[model samples]
Target: MIQQSLVLTGKQKLAWLENEVRDLKDDELLICTIAGAISIGAELPQYNETDVTDCNPVYPRETGYESYGQIIRMGKEVTGFAEGDRVLAFYGHKNLGVVKANKTVKVPDDVEYRYALLNTLSCDAAKGVLKLQPQRDDKVLVTGAGTIGLLTVHFLKNYMNVKHIDVLEPNDKRRELAHELGASHTYSKKEQISSTYYDYGLECSASKDAFHSVLNSMKHHGEVCILSDGNKDLFYLTEDFYEKELKIVASSDGWDYQKHSQWFFKETVKVPQLSKIFEAEITSDQLIHCFEELSESHNKPLKVLVRYL
Candidate 1:
């Protein structure tokens, strides 16, 4: 079948190109339409074609991941899932494709496809939250109010039940959204935090500066969990690091599927507002224009869902 997929050929421009896909294998499942995420400004560093060298710095020449789709066809070996089942997978932004059965998880019938598309991110946030292990009364500061940051805030408040939650975000829209998501206080920057110290800090901004800000705000022997991935190097003064006896840890995409499933089910019930963060939904045909619009918009979109149908 002829399938359309969105490929990032340049820095921020996406091309909706068509290609042919083969039939599903016995151990594979055929996915129909789904939603995927764009990592243009996050993982992909902006650069001109003139800068290309033997380095080939870009790890993924084509970008896009985090997809959830309906199972149009299932292989004979697939036991848990059937045809027409809604499943979430680590697939790209392709309109149709075959994915190994083990890599896909069936989404609950009650959950929306957009919300299911966030399965990977939600899992990542849950893993980070689990690692932080914040106490109920701890004053927790979450840096960055982006999707992951806000999701971390939601999990901290709802899942962990951490009462004193604060968020630091430069964007006004995101800061406000953080407030609505259960942050007790919100600041435009770390310097604006009224509290002198926090028991724990969840650094989600992926900015080296933000990481340092959180580290500086930590109390003696305080813990800070780094959640975002960035290219910049982080440096801390020897005196400050020793004086505070700070502990820092990093969390990333590796999440146990069983734990993720449990967290997803529980958190989704407690925080239905989690799905509200997605601001825009565009079809595959509008992929290029959507990225352009998002690149130009100053307000900053929280989560933009690319729909394929």
Candidate 2:
């Protein structure tokens, strides 16, 4: 059976590769009919390559780390999940692929596939928000209104009981979206920095300047959660950080659903308002177009999904 999968050939270039589907091994599950795309670290510009001399032609590597689909086939060793179950996994955007059963999480029957696609992101946002240990009265500042940033805001307001939330985003659409998602105030980069000192800061943008802005606006002993990944060397330590004894916490890649009791995906889906964040949806064949749309800096789409037919 030939299956079509999207692969990144070079910087800003995507192509569909058709290949024969392989059978699932024991302890593995075969996913089919993928629902949405999750922009993992692979989509970042830093991973793109200018030189492609040594790159493979037929199976040019694919980017992205999370996707959702139905389990069409399960190995004999797979006990918890049966065929026809909707599951989310730490896998790339592919029509059909085999993954270890342990890496996949079953989606509830009531939860829509669009929300299920955000499971990995929800877990990441929840992890970062939990690490901050926000207080009910803490003045929170979130830098960046991207998907992770928005999810952080949602978790802070809905779960952490944080009020007086402020979001910093340059894009007008995203700033408005942030306000709708629970941000008490939203500001562009050129706007005058707020006089109110934030007790907690969530750094969700990759820009070093934004990081500095959040750091400067924080109060003494304030804790800031660094959620985005990029060139970190650009961020320098300053006198304010030392004088205030501020704490900067880095959250990344270490989420295990089996070990922890928190069900981030389940909890996030329960919030009906979050569904509004899915800004764009495209079929699997339009994967390249979706990437092109997301590549534009000014286009502030919160979430883009690639639905499989």
Candidate 3:
């Protein structure tokens, strides 16, 4: 079967595109190798409008703003990514793209695909965790225990010296996973947030109410690192921002590495911080669920790495 990069104007139409890599380059390696496949998450929210203009309006830019699987294909040509390398791409959904070489990062062979996909999430975590560095024995609160939030737990506990890492998760199973993943404490968003000792707050959950929770529960002059992608228009965030004097930094893909032009025999590059945030690398043998499994997912570790087993 030939492989085609599937695109949908809306997510409900995704059922038709699922598993539909029907147009291929006919190269045995293209089918056999992991080159053509990519990873993705965050399906089009079903209830939301399909047009997705405002609220989720084109992020990076029109047409190119699509995240998840879109980036894998969008960055294919411009980024000098060499074909055949195991790339850790954040282009969303289960891998579907025609990406260029440089746009992708090389995944070490020992890393699992699930973990490699998890690595893309670490970009923001790297930023958040770095903020609390030299740890100061300061208590930390992470308001969301999903993949990214839980991943943050792994980073803070294993890598940093923070006095405590508290997690806020509504999902029971995910809460268990957070503890297993090394969270010092966990709470449901429904429960009242305690300002016992936390000096830093990382809001990975995009829940509208959680933003206020981040501010209300934080200690005086505490740092609030928001890693979600949403409009500040969700509510008036300015007053508390000014009143609490909180350093509320919006980290919705704000990182852009400026590199020197590549010249023969010389290259200047700013490496991504995947290893610091991702749980670990994954190999092709660990490929689990495919595109379909990820799209319709309700509760599953949608995190994955795409490669031929």
Q: Estimate each model's TM-score.
A: 0.87, 0.86, 0.64
Provide the lowest-lDDT 10-residue window in model 2.
46-55
- Residue 67 of model 3 has an lDDT of 21
Ranking by TM-score: 1, 2, 3
Candidate that scores best on TM-score: 1
Q: Which ranges in model 3 have alpha carbons more than 4 Å from their true place?
A: 1-3, 15-41, 46-84, 90-97, 131-136, 189-192, 231-233, 238-242, 254-309
lDDT of 2 by residue, 1-309 (tens): 676677777667778788897877899998886676746333645234422223433335676676778888888889999888988776677778779999878877777777766666766877887888888898999988888888788878877878889999888888887887789999897245663298888888877788888878888998988888643324666666887789998898546653321455556546766776787777777777666765665554567677787
Question: Candidate 2: how large is its RMSD?
Answer: 3.8
Which 10 successive residues of model 1 have the least lDDT summed? 46-55
Report lDDT (CA) for all predictions.
0.74, 0.74, 0.49
lDDT per residue as tens, model 3, 288-309: 2243444456654423333333
Better of 1 and 2 by TM-score: 1
TM-score of 3: 0.64
Evaluation by lDDT, superior candidate among 1 and 3: 1
